[model samples]
Target: MVFHLFGLRALEVWLYSRLIRSPIFHQMVGRVHRRVEQIRHGIPPEESRTKLEGSGSLDKFVRYFKEEIQDQMKGKPRNKL
Candidate 1:
């Protein structure tokens, strides 16, 4: 049973890797990211839907995610060791 579960997990990882490398996957992520940005910026959902047609590269998505994370981190108080 353990071996079977491990095999399934390995297959999932392989499939995920391939999916991320595909242009289609990146494009889909890009679209989602753009829609999220529009909503975050207070754009009306009706307008955002029409503006969802745009291109996004994996690099841009990664950078945007990183920036968001950093900004969130900056707003919280950190404990010093």
Candidate 2:
């Protein structure tokens, strides 16, 4: 039973790793992120859709992820107990 559980966990991890590594997955995540941001900024849904549709380049996607990571790191308190 323990071995079976471990095998299942390993398989889950492998599947998640592959999914995360896929470019299509990144593109989908990027789209969702942009949509959320636009909504948060009070952009109308139609306008947001148009803006998102115009900005799906690979370079923009990479830069977006990089900026998101930097923004996240900036918000953390440096010295946790």
Candidate 3:
């Protein structure tokens, strides 16, 4: 639930950026996604890969939720220094 909230927040922010015509915001969103992919691949944390083998929507949602939350929290806000 928390993770979904985080991803939803990010999606909202990105949509807002698109409305505002900010290329920078789009770039920020891309960076966030890349970080999530890196985490899932265990680039730094070195987590073992698990194969779910064609799971349901809930399974996909949970994994995506976790990755989005982790990525967003670690990312720097666009207006920050």
What does each candidate score in C-alpha RMSD?
15.1, 14.9, 22.5
* Candidate 2: residue pairs that collide: none
Candidate 3 local Cα displacement, residue 53, angstroms: 42
Going through the candidates in the order shown, the clash numbers are 0, 0, 0
Taking all chains together, the TM-score of candidate 1 against the true structure is 0.48
Cα lDDT of model 2 by residue, 1-81, tens digit: 999999999999999999999999999998898799878998765544335444467678889778777777899534423
lDDT per residue (tens digit) for residues 1-81 in model 3: 999999999999998877779877777887788789888886664443565557686688799778777778989434323
TM-score of each: 0.48, 0.52, 0.29
| Candidate 1, number of clashes | 0
List the candidate 2 regions with Cα displacement exceeding 4 Å. Answer: 44-81
Using lDDT as the yardstick, the better of models 2 and 3 is 2
Backbone clash pairs for candidate 1 read none
Worst 10 residues of 2 by lDDT: 46-55
How do the residues 9-63 of candidate 1 rate in per-residue lDDT, one tens digit apiece? Answer: 9999999999989999898998898789878998755543344344665567688
Error of 2 at 77 (Å): 51
Q: TM-score of predicted model 3?
A: 0.29
Best by lDDT: 2
Clashing pairs in 3: none
lDDT of 2 at 31: 86
- Measured with C-alpha atoms, the lDDT of residue 44 in candidate 1 is 58
| Runs in model 3 lying further than 4 Å from the true structure | 1-20, 43-81
